[model samples]
Target chain A: MVSALGIQLGVVGAYLLVALAVGLLAYRLTSRDAEDYYLAGRSIGTVVLLFTTFATLLSAFTFFGGPDLAYRAGPEWILVMGVMDGVLFALLWYVVGYKQWLVGKAHGYVTLGEMLGDRFGSKRLRALVAGISLFWLFPYVMLQQMGAGEAIVGLTNGIVPYWAGAAGITVFMIAYVVIAGLRGVAWTDTLQGLFMLGVVWLAVGWVATAAGGPSALSNALATNKPEFLALGGGLYSPQFIISTAITIAFGVAMFPQINQRFFVAKSGAVLKRSFALWPVLVVLLFVPAFILGTWAAGLGISVPEGANVLPVLLNEYTPVWFAALVVAGAMAAMMSSSDSMLLSGSSYFTRDLYRPFVDASLSDAREAWIARIGVALFATLTFVASLFRPGTLIEVGDTAFGGFAQMALPVIIALYWARTTRSGMFAGIVGGQLFYLAHVFVPAFEIAGITVLGGTYLTWDFALWGMVLSALLTLGVSSLTAAAPEENQSRFSEGLRAD
Target chain B: MTRTSIDYLWIVTFAILVTFAVPWFLWGDSRVFAGLPLWLWWHIGWMVLAAVVFHLFTRRAWDRGIVEGGR
Candidate 1:
């Protein structure tokens, strides 16, 4: 008879093999052109686009962090991630993504830097945007690796060391990304997305039933921790909820992986349909994870740390095979996110940073090859960084989100506002980043015992302030600076203006 | 491509939905219904309403200048 550990490992191994097979199959279908490799030839249909975007956006954060937060803080996490960001991000998809698709289609742009650079006629600005995106993206990519490591270690009870687990995913993702690029990433994302959804719901049902269903779970919570049943107390303050919601929504809009997706849908109809369904998909995944986490608290389940709550709870309540399947689902979430980030990061380096700055005359085939190399190097570097285990998954993820949130103002201004100049964009991007860093790195300011900047001021997160500063700089600087040439402005504005 | 009354209506509708999504109104109320808090039930209904609004928006107003202009 097979041992429980063997069965668990077998399920995870089988999942990885299937993922690799899917990636290789996509490699066969992919063409050699840069566009085809990077953006799937901009021909992704509604279903693939929806699932890929869904999978790419909902990472270890949703699978692990969401449950962890609910376990500690309560169900108010549902307010922050589920109800608020779900609808808000979908709105942004329409407000910002639609316009981006139009502009990208018209210009044949592949990266955000390329689009912004062309609009303002500034190569330096393009490089700046690429640099900042890469800087923030690095931590987020490492977040996935760290999550994979911890998750694998959690499932195997230390049989698989953290470094090996991180390395395993990094190697697998790099192999597939280099093999088929966005085509493989998207196809695999669809499969992994489906796998994650099904497994998470199953885990929720099994655990809930074992705990005597939702009513019993709620009774447990009501008796043990009643604050979780209400709102506006402790960590679930009104300001905390609103600020987190805004920051995450805007930050998601600027994620390089997600932003690149705006240009990948085959038609406007596909884009519309995808955004329309995004909120519902988000709800379906987030609610179950958060509810389970909240229920864990009531059930008096103990975990080493918040991040370990889901895995520990599953082991205690569910069957061994089911636990392994859920762990694989969590791995699916991590790999789906990491692969997309690596693929998009490569596009940024090759198209925006290297080609324009290093070798302006590089051939398309050579550029594609360079991007593959970049993915390998990038994945390897982040894998090594993941070994350090810098911060908790939520802390590291929040920092990256805030960093990217600084870019949203400049992007929106560049897209809709005609007067947006290259210098203004630079000032906003750099100034906001510096200020945010000051808040992050510097100790709280005090003048003779009076508190100032650093940490949440009056309950608002530093990210909200960073975004406000970014917008002010962008608008203030653009007003004083000369506008880009009217013809250049018209490239975006002419097509986007309502008739 | 032109802005319509329907577009304005959706903008207002979504704005209201977002405003009420936060359970400030339910502060200090710990009533549990069906083994869940009243606030949780509020969010469940709110999300369902939001999804419906989104579907309606896509049918009625999703295509603006971008779609037609791209084609």
Candidate 2:
């Protein structure tokens, strides 16, 4: 008999080759200019823009980690992604993205640091923002690499080592980004988004139906694991749920990869249309994953604790070919996210750090060259970090999300609030990171099974403390300091009113 | 309708409903509705409501200047 693992890897390898071909095709349409390379010539249409954003936002964490969480905890986890994030993030796109698009278009910005730096009139602040983003982003990029490694190991039953899987993806991503830049990343992301959206639903739907319909699945949980269907169920408390929703919403708003997407949008209407449909897409994709995860419990499918539940479910319920396709689909989600992040991180280093600080007069072609190199360097670093496997994909992703969320207050203040001085923005960012990092790095006490941070008496999540303290410091410092120049305030206010 | 400050109310309402209003009151309720718990459905319901709210919010006058640029 032909090796089933060999056949599965063959199918996955074929899918990856097709993605590479798409990147080359996009290269033909790309221009040689730095703007075109980094921002896709600012010419992305509605459907492509929407799906790229969707695919990039829904990463390996969403595809693999979400199902695992639902299986491990309960259906309450669905509320975290399916319900709150769908709507909350869409609104945040409008509130933050619209402004960013307007300002970026007017100023010809390619990175968030550039925008923040110009608005604050401080190169140090721009470098600081970019540095902070990269610091948080490293773990997030590592999570995707680690997720791909775990997925490949799970799919092939350890025939392929974890290090090989991570290295293969890192090399592929560097090739993709170098071939077509943002345009290539966007085209492939659109294709992968559609693949992930379709394959996940079909595979999960098939599995759930095979394990008896919804009611039967529900009946099994009610009989043996009613707590899985109950409120205050599993690991999520109400405070945990509420705080995560808040953190994720703010986190999505400030992600460097997601933030840079505003600059690639073809027009304001395209961005608007994408945000409007975001929640619908979230519901469609997420509901099935939750159902399938909950159904796994009912079917008594045994998954190793902390391992990805997806490959386990597919192995038992689906055929080899179908499981291969599902694994490929999961890899697609990881690749789409990883490519965008690599591109964004490189742009931060090139546009925000290198051009601004290292060589102010660098030529456009040379800048693009530096950016491609940055992609390779960043991907390699993240790949190296993935080997250590510090945390699970979801845990690593959540830590990054908390850091980004802390920056949201400073970002909003920088944009909408006129009195926000450079000092205020700087202090807000530092104070927030200090508070959040202190909590994250220091071990917390587990008293009676509730995790309490070392200093805080209550069990409230660290993200809440970071955001609240950051916003207060921003406000208090801005009030004490002289306002930004009148010219700057008018410039921002004018951008807000433009229509 | 021409955009006014009031166009933000629905989102404000949406924010409150998801983050504070419903989660505090209804999320801990253990009643099963559909195949999932009541609070889970409440979140789904809020998603639908949020869609409607965002649809209305987007319809309000937004800066059209950015829409008429390079294709």
Candidate 3:
């Protein structure tokens, strides 16, 4: 490790120095109050809101995983996942996101749990939500760490060890989050988002051009793996149904970071304008990762299973300068997600946990400081998890996504449907979580004449399928029960728009 | 039908047209749509829907008086 990429130690030092600078800046900005720390005093306009939303949702995984999925599972999975993500944002651009931001602003809710608990009149619900957030977010943080390590390794040609990269990323992330709070996160996210767009466009174009263009790559891949061209490749089994897509699409608008994007928007008009441009952003950004992945497969590069595909591919194909930019882009992706999660994580602990339970009398300034420490603590723990777990960060982060999506149907149904009761949301959350866990960890069941797919034996990740069972339980239970208190029911809709 | 129901049907019809009808007609045989890629078509669908939804909002929002709110 000492003689690694062997760039002078100063190179790594500069990265850490920039991170510390960013963190100090954020910490100073946020040291005053929770409002400023948590939501940037709602000062973000359309431009900042647009970039922050874009970067916060994209990470090294979104950039790398598309190509990784293409390389390992064939092309079907990339198309399915990529298209699902696109559809998800489009759906959010419409109905779901508006409801979230409007309701959140009307009541000063920071965490989804806070929003749900306030609406449903249950404090325990808040705790349940915060706990679930911690459960899944830890892995996401770990993924950023893993991505940090992989990016450094690719750039230095394994001159840097995994732990150094992880520690470097962790320090940078913690500093950045503490320095700017939401303000820093938003500005850096905006910069990183724009920077990475250029990086991805160049990488994809270069890869395709080197391989003799898109059609030639398509021809090469067709010869090697024909299913790479199919909607559902051989045994890859792309789940491209309308219902399945609708399920994935609808769930996208509901991610906590995405919902939080709404809370900071200057106005609904700003949000709408940003969302209107989102499709172009989507195509410009993630679609390139997919094209690069397909191009890699065409060039006959045997990409490793679950590796950081974009940087790995870029390192293999492009020049050192471009490769360095890809490395920087990977770090930017890591920082994008980490800063948002740090602010978001601290918000849950401060607003949802501390203020609600142990320290209501604490000054907002003190709470803001506590949030800085909380970011540090969260960063440390997730780093430790990445160190210990090592390989599962990306998938675990995806699993954590289910934590948000599982809550989606109930949240939306409760918001829109008059028949939706507190019990519905509660049952939906609890039942959905249990079903999701069981469908993930438990097995199939065969009783009497009926045989359940995951009931009798433990099976694979049934993310969308789990939501179906959960949704049924929520709706059925709600229909059989009385409605929530009318006061609670009408609070959200009063200030929100269905358009 | 009532106005809201008409709006709902409009969304459903648009969903079907782009999600299926257009795709089936133009790229049913995997041919690109006028040399634009398949993914571009999806992008077009996303952009078109976005334009339509926001256009309707600006045109018919009919908020006689809107309230200023906080976060």
Candidate 2 docking class: acceptable
Please write out the lDDT profile of model 2 over residues B1-71, one tens digit for every residue: 43333445544666564563235576456566655667766766767766676666567534422233311
Superposed Cα deviation of residue A19, candidate 2 (Å): 1.5
List residue ranges in candidate 3 displaced over 4 A: A1-40, A235-251, A304-306, A388-394, A442-461, A483-487, A495-499, B17-71
Ranking by lDDT: 1, 2, 3
RMSD of 3: 4.6
- TM-score, every prediction: 0.93, 0.91, 0.84
Query: Per-candidate interface C-alpha RMSD?
Result: 2.6, 3.6, 5.5
Which regions of candidate 1 fall more than 4 Å away from where they truly are? Answer: A29-40, A179-182, A305-307, A484-487, A496-499, B1-8, B64-71
- Cα distance off (Å), candidate 1, residue A464: 0.4
Q: By descending TM-score, how would the candidates be arranged?
A: 1, 2, 3
Lowest lDDT sum, 10 consecutive residues, model 3 chain A, at A235-244
Ranking by DockQ: 1, 2, 3
Q: How good is chain A of candidate 2, measured by TM-score?
A: 0.93
Model 2: how far is A441 from its true place, Å?
A: 1.9
Worst window of 10 by summed lDDT in candidate 2 chain A = A490-499
Q: Each model's C-alpha lDDT?
A: 0.79, 0.75, 0.63
Instruction: Candidate 2: give its CA RMSD in angstroms.
Output: 3.8
